[model samples]
Target: MSESIRNLLEQVKNGQVSVDTALLKLKTKPIDDLGYAQVDLHRVVRQGVPEVIYGAGKTGEQIVGIISSMKANGQCQILITRLSPDIAVYIQKKYEMTFVESAHIGYIGDIPIQKTKSSIAIITGGTSDYKVAEECAVTAEFYGNKVERVYDVGVAGIHRLLQNLERIMSAKVIVVIAGMEGALASVVGGLVDVPVIAVPTSVGYGTSFGGVAALLSMLNSCASGVTVVNIDNGFGAAYMANMINHIGESK
Candidate 1:
């Protein structure tokens, strides 16, 4: 259960809040209908993480409205992914937020405190893949996981990746980001005992098919522990990595 639900139940047991009042709160708190968007107010209660705004197609006003509803429902921190710098500027005028242009991610309110000691390693095959890698790093950090970034370590430069063996080996989870054949994920997967999440970026020549080639390459990886996400889906990779990193930790 969420902290709010547990506290509410405790209050009812101690007669601080009437049972009927608590019931009413529970019945009405799950969703907030805004016509344009049905803001999920109870996602934190169910998934331990609040709803994240996808700002690609959303107007600045719509994003602000969702943030308003979330804040009114007691969600202090909000994450907005795939947000454009222009929309970010418009949102910032109303609410103070940090925007990362490279990752196209926005943060509202303070980042959560770290919940575990384990760290997540993010490795990028080439400099062109840094944008996707940054998204993974920011998402993982926002979720309170310590992140170690080893960028431009693609298989082309095998020595560079090998030099970072200690950092990669010590991580609880690893996110390997690459484009142009995407062989880096398999290489890392073979060396690490932990799970490897592969993200294929749209950063290659004409024949890459906008990351399809890399995605297929990762899916067909020979390594045992390698897993693949959709093209440029850093947020998904980070979410799964954070879950794996926090396993057995007290929520």
Candidate 2:
């Protein structure tokens, strides 16, 4: 059983909660059907993380309604990825949220306090990859893990990455965000003992095939620890990294 459920049972035993109320809380439906959205209320209980809103295809009103449903179900922190500034403005009228333009993320509620001593490192191949790197950083931090950012360290200038060897080596998990040939993942994977998640962005030229080339390159990485996510999928990379970073630690 989850800690929250155990605490609820304890409250019932202590007479702090009425039996009917406890039953109602326990019997709460895992999915809240909100017509347009079926919000997963039991995700936190099952996965130790809440369901995140993918804001790209959603309108402001739909997003607001989902947020309302989540809030009503006692979910405090919400993460919205690929959110636009305009839609953020519309949602801001209803609830306070921090919108990060670079990462295109909207966050509701306070970032959780760090949960573990080990950290996740977010490394980028170039300045252009900062957008993806920021997305990984924000998602990792929101999940209560410390993040170290190492930007503009692609293989083109091996010295730049070499300079941050300490930070790279110390991380519990590392996320490598890069475009073009996406060779950074292999390089970093070869260097770090920890897991390396590679993200390929659509920032390269025509021959790059809109990040497909990078995606393939990363998929074929020779480094043992290297793993690849979809093109421009920073959130997925961070989510996996968070799980690895939090291994053996309490949620």
lDDT of 1 at 87: 96
> Candidate 2, 140: how far from true, in Å?
0.7
lDDT tens digits, residues 137-191, model 1? 9999998888999999989889999999999999999999999999999999999
The residue pairs in collision within model 1 are none
Q: Which residue pairs show backbone clashes in model 2?
A: none
Q: 1-251, model 2: which lDDT tens digit per residue?
A: 45577788899999999999999987889999988899999888777678999999999999999999999999888999999999999999999999989999999998877456899989999999988889889998888888999999999999999999998899999999999999999999898888889999988999999999999999999999898999999999999998899887763
Per-model TM against the reference: 0.93, 0.93
Worst 10 contiguous positions by lDDT, candidate 2: 1-10
**lDDT of each model, Cα atoms only?**
0.93, 0.91
